[model samples]
Target: MTTMTRAELGALGEQLAVDHLTGQGWAILARNWRCRYGELDVIATDPGTRTVVFVEVKTRSGDGFGGLAYAVPPEKVRRLRRLAGAWLVGQQSHWDEVRLDVIGVRIGRCRIPEITHLQGVG
Candidate 1:
């Protein structure tokens, strides 16, 4: 198989993540939402729970950079929270709950890529 570039791998991972979310019946609100702070990988709503979720997607080819658990450190979580706040301020909708989640996509290790989702991360 041909080697995938970093950007291509990331994009593929994000697309897989979106597919996973939609398969779970979640309504995607935004993706790659950008601001001065940074970009949010995905934003979606849980219709059943009436919650708004902010997602951070980390894509990896292997266990490099300490793997998925170490991808979103405390500082990164803080930044994500700030980004979520910035996103919320511009919204006209309200929800019963808001949460931060991390989705780690690991590719090139097996026939199928592995996906790990951590909820309420921050």
Candidate 2:
């Protein structure tokens, strides 16, 4: 088997997250949605709940740093909120519940990646 490099692994983690969200019945609205404030990795809509989810993807190969979720700070959340608003405007989405979700992808040593979904990071 071909060992995935850093970038490839990171990309795989992100794609897995998108697919995971899709499996959860979320309609993917945008990927890498950007604004002046910051970028939202994935913007998905839950038609059943009428909610918009702004996703931040954090991929890690090891616990070298604190943790993957640590990358998403409060300021980052604020920035994501702004970008989420812009996305909403573009999509004309009137959502009752706007949430921030952090997907932490942990690549263990010779193991399948693990996904942790933390909602309302703010």
Top candidate (lDDT): 1
TM-score of each: 0.94, 0.84
How far is 59's C-alpha from truth in model 1 (Å)?
0.7
Q: What digit string (tens of lDDT, one per residue) describes model 2 on residues 16-52?
A: 8998899888899888777776668888887678788
The number of clashing residue pairs in model 1 is: 0
- lDDT (0 to 1) per candidate: 0.91, 0.82
lDDT of 1 by residue, 30-69 (tens): 9999999999999999768999999898888887798676
